[model samples]
Target: MYETKKWKSKFFIVAFGQAISLLGSHGVQFALIWWLAEKTSSPLMLGISGLVAYLPMTLFSPVAGIAADRLNRKIICIVSDLSMGILAAVYAGLLFFFDLPVWTVFIMLCARGIGNTFQQPAIQSIIPQLVPSDQLVKTNGWMQLMNAGSFFLGPVIGASLYAAFPMSVVLISDIIGAALASAALAVVKVPELEKHQLEQEPIARQLKEGFTVFQADSKLFYLVLGEALCMFFYAPLSSFYPLMTSDYFNLSAMYGSAVELAFALGMMISSLMFSSVLKIKRKIRTSFIGLFGMGISAAVCGLIPPTYWGWFFFAAACVCLGASGNIHSIPLTAYIQETVAPERMGRAFSVLTLISSVTMPVGLLAASPVAEKVGVNVWFFLSGAIMIIITSILIWYSKMKRRHP
Candidate 1:
């Protein structure tokens, strides 16, 4: 119990630091999107900026993961934060001195994505070191809470800052937050794992090993496939929801705010449930149920007609998505941490990140065209349906294996 308490303390500290950093980053991102939209009035530009920011994580994650496996994970974290901070400062300078063009914003966003390619894998891999195996769910709950909080607070703070000052000043907040995150990491003491010293191995061989692990483990394969599909379909809500609410429903900016807030609230509530109330004998079963529920709620929200009543349903659906997502992610993360050897954690996380990154751009690209051709409502409906179908197939497969075995 004493050891558990100590681990919890460390976990909270790291979670807190990350929460702060994420809050600042999310705020800056939202503020920038709004700024660009107001300045250019072009959805295409916003889509381009989004693409630039996310595509690197998909492309570079494997390399970053290998670097994490071969080096000090803490150092990787520090370097990534510092690099991102520098980029944020540069963005501020551009906004201050020159009329920031679309290309410039895209370039800066790409730089940040490159930095995150390193940061995300290192961070995900390090969580296991900070908590006990049995406490993985609780620790993950806190992490989800931080995630939800960032989404909840970032946009409001960012918009407020942008209103009160110039974009340069607003961007400064991210720099400061990143610096603080680096400092927090510096102070934390984590048990160091031996770096993979197989320097003679080709990068291709190393990457192949990471993929081999996933391929060999049928459970992991299904889990990853489910995760990738969910990300691919679910990501569009972030890009298209504001337009949907404002244009389709003919609601005010307040409606967009409400939608975002509702989503965050759902996440927050679900995190709490996972930590405090929900319990399951089988983690896989719980994950399947959560994913299925999220899909169902999403589909229902899409099908409902636009009205005040529909807004409530949409908010409810958002809550279901958040809760179910947290339930699925916590176990998946813990399983990876436990199953992978310490030295390989970095590479494992990197591969996972790579899969996530690769899928997101595809998802975004798909969302825009689908929204244009069919309508955002249809897109949402189809995406949700896909999630449900995919999850059902995986779950059925898992059940058959269990019965046979």
Candidate 2:
């Protein structure tokens, strides 16, 4: 319908606005986490909070994907943002009126998660339509940059707002952001998917068709599984990073900021490199390189003790993990965009999100207790070992089959 220049221009407009909204949403997320931590002081409650936020996405993302394919994605995205804004407003109003329990906040977060469920697949499905195939990797890398930028700045802003203002105010800020996002999306012209009779089939059957694409390309299936394994190994390491930084390395709470900053900086650097320098043709091989780098850095971080140079080593590992991770994810995403049939992309991406998460919840549930028993440092080392082992197997298998993310 349009040339690369036109689509690219529209893409930037949408992306820029979405990035602004993302920053606000992330800020509110951290604010709520900090608020819950301050109020509950119960690890059990905090853990439950995490579960409530993520589980809905895992459960309903496929359904959301189905809806995205069936419905107008532009409308879906706008409605998602506006709905979140309304919910945030109402929730904030309730908090202002009376002393709402922690359960209320958790429930609201679950709603936010559901909003994300619809929004994420819709956006992913929309991206390929917005950019030329050759530019997918560059665009994906830029998206990663926006995410990393939000991650780096959101918490700081959220913490500051939380400290200076009330919870209601922080929530209201999220609403403003949501409104801005919706307004931006409201203007973008998204090309519609042409409908087919098969799409009108039963939901269960439609979903089955989605899964059947992987059978058509077993390499894609294997690629998704390999990434799933990476995500699984990453769970314990990510969840317990603060604990390891504080307890294992004798770093202060503030020191965790430096570690996170290092990761963000790495992501930014990788994003820039991907956009310019890294023309990653062997996308699968690039992902493997990243996996190996991540595994080695994580292992080294775990093995190092709290000596004078401990912080330096830990910071370096975090940077490597973050940079390599961006390198890993960009091409895989671009590969999916390039490879999958346009008609089935929504389901394909949703399935990837779904199957790639098979172990993460399990990992999250098990990590705390495992770390307690084995020591947090030990947990990191174990995750790194798992990563390395899995990557090695994948590499050998790929070589044997001459298959490729």
Candidate 3:
């Protein structure tokens, strides 16, 4: 059994290490996205970039989750980090010596996506093992805060470094961050779950079992589906941000970074609020409000004109977008951890990841050309309006079921 008294310290150690890793990862990612936006200036190219970055994870998450359930998760984390570091080193060299082909960047993104595929499930599964059951929500909130904080700093550093130095120099931070993360994870011991009898099962069976776990609970299943839909609408927004800031507003990368920072600030603020001050009992209610809020924010972003004031308003909308996202995400994740069986939690999360993964690509593909034809901002308006409609329907249905049942 794990020692309760030492859990907090252990958790913080892991959190600190992850914060470092995330900071580097976020910084490199910002630089790459800015590069892509400047290079192509095509919504379709941006869409493809998102696909390359996410497709590997989408494809492998189920197997990765199974591995998390059966293997040593700490080892998985170490290997994934080391591999990513090595990949970054190689890419950095190419950037230093020669003009790297854009296609190669997509390949690097695919490899990075695969690393994340394995690492995320392992890290998420480890959380319940470390924290007390009662404190799971607060702990998840803290995790979000750490992530948002890292992202908050990442853009500032990335923007400054990108403006001053070569891409190769910015990449060195990832190598160092990954090394530190590996070292930190190496020393900290994570408690392992007892082996399940299902260990004898084949991969296909295990994969199917992950899906069946949710089938047993209809509400949980639908909740996952509802969130999946929200992600579908939200996926395009990720690709559109740089475009909106640059092409639509005719702003510089600094302005784009400011918009990102605003979103991160909102995330940090909401994370602190929900994790500490607000003990929300009805998490579903909070999720509904979050969903509605995100829709409103997106619509408002679309409506903003191409003016200095418009850019400021756009940044403000992104802040609302970020806060609402956390409000929706944190509660639902906590609820899953609270309700799902400990042994099957990895698979549960994998299933959730898998569904979201499937929808995201489709969302990107469907929106890319259309956004290219119409204005990027116009798509944002339409997506947000549709999201509101969907949320309203879900809310009405949820209430009806409650009343009748």
Best by lDDT: 3
Tens digits of lDDT, candidate 2, 1-405: 346668877887777778778878877876786566556544445556666776777898789878878888888888999899899999989988988887888799789878888887788878887788989899888888877787677667776787788888898778988898888878888777777886879989878766787777766666666777876767546545655655576665346556766777788889888877779888877877787778877887788777758888888888888898887778878888898777777787778667544455666677656766677777678778888888889877878786433
TM-score of each: 0.92, 0.90, 0.97
RMSD of each: 2.5, 2.8, 1.4
Error of 2 at 336 (Å): 1.0
**Candidate 1 structure lDDT:** 0.77
Write the candidate numbers in order of decreasing TM-score. Answer: 3, 1, 2
lDDT of 3 at 287: 74
**lDDT digits (tens) for residues 1-405 of candidate 1:** 125557777777778888888888978887777666556544455556668878998788888988887778889888998898899998798788988665677888899999889998888878888777677777777788888998888877886887789989999879988888888888878777654465468888888767777787778777787877787887666666655565556565555656666777878887877677765446656666777877886787679677867776776777677677777777677677768776677787788787777766778787877676666777778888998998999888877986896
Q: Rank the candidates by lDDT, best first.
A: 3, 1, 2
Q: Ten residues in a row with the worst lDDT in model 2?
A: 37-46
Flag regions of model 3 displaced more than 4 Å.
none
Clashing residue pairs, candidate 2? none
Model 3 per-residue lDDT at 141: 89
- Residue 68, candidate 2: Cα error in Å is 1.8
